[model samples]
Target: MTTYTPPQRTATLADAPAIAALMRASVLELFPRFYDERQTASAAKHIAAIDLLLIEDGTYFVHEADGEIVACGGWSKRNKTHAGDGDAADDDRPLDPATEPARVRAMFVRGDWTRRGLGRAILESCRLAAKAAGFTSLTLTATMPGVPLYRSFGFTEVERVMMTTPDGVDIPGAIMVKDIDRPDSIGP
Candidate 1:
């Protein structure tokens, strides 16, 4: 069994380029399993860019090993659940923790680090942080290859969303949601 290490710290602006490169590598190498080349490339171009606001909000995290970032992901208390850097609009208003589910955004792993529990580690960090922020539930728009991982983490399919890239390419994804349990009800 692989032992996962906790993320080093919340992401910062300086980490954006590395995170973006990792996202591109992960997408190019993994997305092909579920998407055609055109679809994969289009989706990569649209999605690999990180939202700087997430890092600014201090919710984004990155795990490093051997002096390099191996995994990255985060949760958001904002209305905009998904978007790349250049794609984010002005409607990214904060969400009320009491009324809305926190969003799990921008999960990506280095291609060589796949299936090493790194993704799950970052996910647990997001869940715990979201729960502590008073969110009772979480939601994320999962790329096709990410469905199984989200399912393994107890998220259920809530809806299917088709995102049209700026170049007019439609990428399919699923909205997955999970309810967070109170500390008292969590099982060992």
Candidate 2:
């Protein structure tokens, strides 16, 4: 018997709905273990949204199998570090690669696809793309369920943060960073 893996490609505007669905499902199914009910629900409502800027910037990606998007993620050269951050005014500002880290944003994998290297594969693609664009480092705000994956990819927690949802629920998360230009900072 053989297993077939779907190939990843850049996401388009047409993929937004599928990518959004995958992100919401990934959060709702995976976050309960690390967060309370309210936190999980709030995050699913806010953080799991699709950032159209990533798609327009050609930085978002999706892995489709049988015409269904099973996994999605992306890196951004823009100033928006994450969705639902409540700073939409400056979200589209381009980051200076020489002075700022590129952002690894909006990563998601279907619940059944956990531990299958999909997250790592997306991070590797992000790293290479950011490097090619002259960024020496990468940064992300990782929800609790995603901490281990980011750590395994050489990201270090810079600080703990609490994001307040529109409904005023506080969700705890971490800001992680990786100096991708370092020789020892290679992806897992």
Counting clashing residue pairs in each candidate, in order, gives 0, 0
Error of 1 at 91 (Å): 3.4
Local distance difference test, candidate 2: 0.88
**Model 2 deviation from native, Cα RMSD in Å:** 2.0
Question: Which digits, one per residue and each the tens of the lDDT, describe model 1 over residues 37-76?
Answer: 9989987888887788889999999988877888898989
Residue range 1-188, candidate 2, lDDT tens digits: 45566898999999998998998999999999999999899889999988888999999888888999998999999998786546668888999999999999999999988877778878888998899999999999898888999998889999999878788988889999998765325444
Where does candidate 1 stray beyond 4 Å? 1-7, 85-90, 182-188
Candidate 2, pairs of clashing residues: none
Clashing pairs in 1: none
Report the Cα RMSD per candidate.
Answer: 2.7, 2.0
lDDT of each: 0.83, 0.88
